[model samples]
Target: MTSSSTQHRPPIGIITTLRSSLPFLFFLLLLLYLISTSKLLIYPPHITTKITCQDSNLTTTNNHPKTGYDTELKHIAFCIAASSKLWKSRKEYIKLWWRPGETRGAVWLDNQVKIKKNETLPDIHISQDTSRFPYTNRQGHRSAIRISRIVSEALRLESDDVRWFVMGDDDTVFVVENVVRVLNKYNHNQFYYIGSSSESHFQNIFFSYSMAYGGGGFAISYPLVKELAKMQDRCIKRYPGLYGSDDRMQACMAELNVPLTKEPGFHQNDVYGNLLGLLSGHPVTPLVSLHHFDVIDPIFPGMKRVESIKHLLESTKYDSGSLIQQSICYDMKREWSVLVSWGFAIQIMRGILSPRELEIPSRTFINWYKVLDFTAYAFNTRPVTGHPCQKPFVFYINSTRYDELRGQIIGIYTVHRERHPRCRWKMESPEKIHTVVVLKQEDPDRWLRAPRKDCCRVLPSRKEGIMYLWVGHCGENEVIEV
Candidate 1:
């Protein structure tokens, strides 16, 4: 009887133990599911990856080791106008013919113009006389044609040694530091000409328009100059009666499939006028030259053009020392001010939404929320309303996750509409009220909305609702309890 009683008791005890452990097992499984689904817990610090060449040999090499031109490679060649017409008075037509250095051009070619320590100045040559050309009435076109001829002669003179020939208007102001920097980037063996390239436009009916180089500035590589010299006669025959010689020259290069690279911060439009502020802040450090078209002013009588060049050369001594330094400081201050304003706005927005914890999946923590926060912070301080994806406040979340979170009200914060004038306010649901936990009294006011008696409600059957939260103001009047 005792043995039978013991067996029944053991079975009953085992059954009781299994029933007690069921609740604990169920709770453990639920916690595991929540941990698996939360994106915020899984990913952090989402970073974009960029591809770069891995070869050690791909690194940039410095070519310009010495101050001046390498004797082995003659690079610089001067193209001076041999027979240029000079006006006697302010309103007068050409009264006398002079060489490049005889009038204002002479001031630029003076002893003060020295080549860099290691850099070499090429053989100088003059352009052919314009009297031989059929188009004598158009002085602008004639000058451009003469410059082209000079470029041809320079290429021919030092055919083997030189790689580039620089042609400039007599009144142009050049910064040698800028030119040397560009020359240093390439191995003297490679050939590439640098200049501005723009699509052609037709402004007047009298002229048939086509793509051309801007008249103010340009630089040609040694190979390009050589090719142009070889094709000079053919270009003249192919494009007969071309309106602008510079345009025609560019067209010739285009026909040869020679691509032009742009060198920014090298040339200035004002030859005599000082550009203390503009060149200093440009991303490109070195500037090549300045093209001052109106250095000889038609407005002021008795203003000798050579006198202006001399004054400008003297002014350079003062500007070179302090002008760039001051401009850089000013630019830094402006950029810092912009960053500070943006940081302040981000702090305010974060403070307003402090009550809510972002409930994202662990996998999405780094990729989605972090990116959104960064974007929102950047755009909030801008003067104008930023584009949706471009601004800091707006972030791209997975559409599926967004859809799940759409109806859920997570925090109380202010919303402002900047660009749109006539925005309509509509309550989506009358039955469902959203509870906004405010930390301060003035938070809702900053958002430009009136206070309400009850916390905002979401209508049970309705699909959408808009609600805002106030910080510190916990009063019945301040709370919108819908």
Candidate 2:
């Protein structure tokens, strides 16, 4: 009976079998649809489907370092304010510092400049549009009135991809790398009014402390630029009394409720003196911009302005932080006190320690910089004693120009000290050291060394730390601190 029932069971309807299996077949088709639409099994998927942890396309205004933002992926636009009268004086500086595509914004002026083929003059000429804003007698006032229009035009002409819009004067020299670094430090998605004060406290007082010196240059984020473009004209109309472009900018920023994000690297250079005190004391930060070189002295004591700038570029290129770190000026105390200024150290006490008493040879003299003092009563670090009387005491001079030789000589006097075993420690007259300067021309990455000759002598290597013989033309000026 079981065999007969089994034989007859499946000879039953195909419709019945199909109906029973429909649910599983339907589930399989649904799974396939989901896989195709969701791209689950696809190899080499599109960007949205790929596992991406970072947005490599970062902008200056949208970057947040903690959020994996990179402004290097973006570009910056520069808006420069210049008068037709001062074009001659400022053209060289523009050529020296400004890059074509980076500084692509217009240079607001009354006339057109004769630009050479490779030379990058301002991208646009902002001639006096008397219809927009009438020309005025006060040049400063005129520039103040023109700023809003200039900024508006720059915002319009620059590619939407531009992340930061910087406003500067004809004299402003931008260290674009440092500027980018500073800008990258903050989340540019938020409004940023970044700049530094003038060198003179009085200048800052005359203007508002909140104001960004036009010469030093200031940066505005793309979002801020859009906001500024909207209100800039109205803001300028409100500040009719403001004479300087910087003051007007400050007034507008205040109206916008955007405070100055003071960046010390943006030097206005309104005051004249050696910058050694400031640069040496603070070496960690980058120097983004420097302005008013015509009024201020060349960075180094004797360097010409152009030479000083070239040296600064070369020094920074060679070692970005070393220029500031190595341009040290400090005083160390011992029985023989030493004053070190701008890489130079001088022994202040004549008879502090007798080399003969210490049993060192007289003819084999030592420069005091070679010595280190670790006695309970003495400062831990000082220059080691080294022979200074040797012929052709070779120094590798990395100067941009010839005028720097005098400064280097003066710098030598500031830190020069000698010790001799045969001599009594007397204040009378230290032995004369004949020094020769050798210019550095080889690769900056390599160690600087003078060609050896029987007539040429070099300082002995110190056990503590060897003093670097190569000095760049742009080294900080001598700053003697007690």
Clash totals for all models, in order? 42, 20
Task: Score residue 417 of candidate 1 by CA lDDT.
Answer: 22
TM-score of each: 0.39, 0.57
Model 1, 267-299: lDDT tens digits are 433212322212222221333454543542421
Which digits, one per residue and each the tens of the lDDT, describe model 2 over residues 126-244? 64463464434454556567655676778778866788888888888776766766787677788999997764545666677788888888888888889988988777777666777
Worst 10 residues of 1 by lDDT: 337-346
Worst 10 residues of 2 by lDDT: 448-457
All candidates' lDDT scores? 0.33, 0.52
Indicate the residue-level lDDT of 269 in model 1.
Answer: 39
Off by over 4 Å in 2: 1-68, 100-104, 127-140, 273-284, 321-466, 469-482
Root-mean-square deviation per candidate: 24.8, 24.0
- Model 1 misplacement above 4 A: 1-74, 81-83, 87-126, 129-140, 197-216, 268-283, 293-482
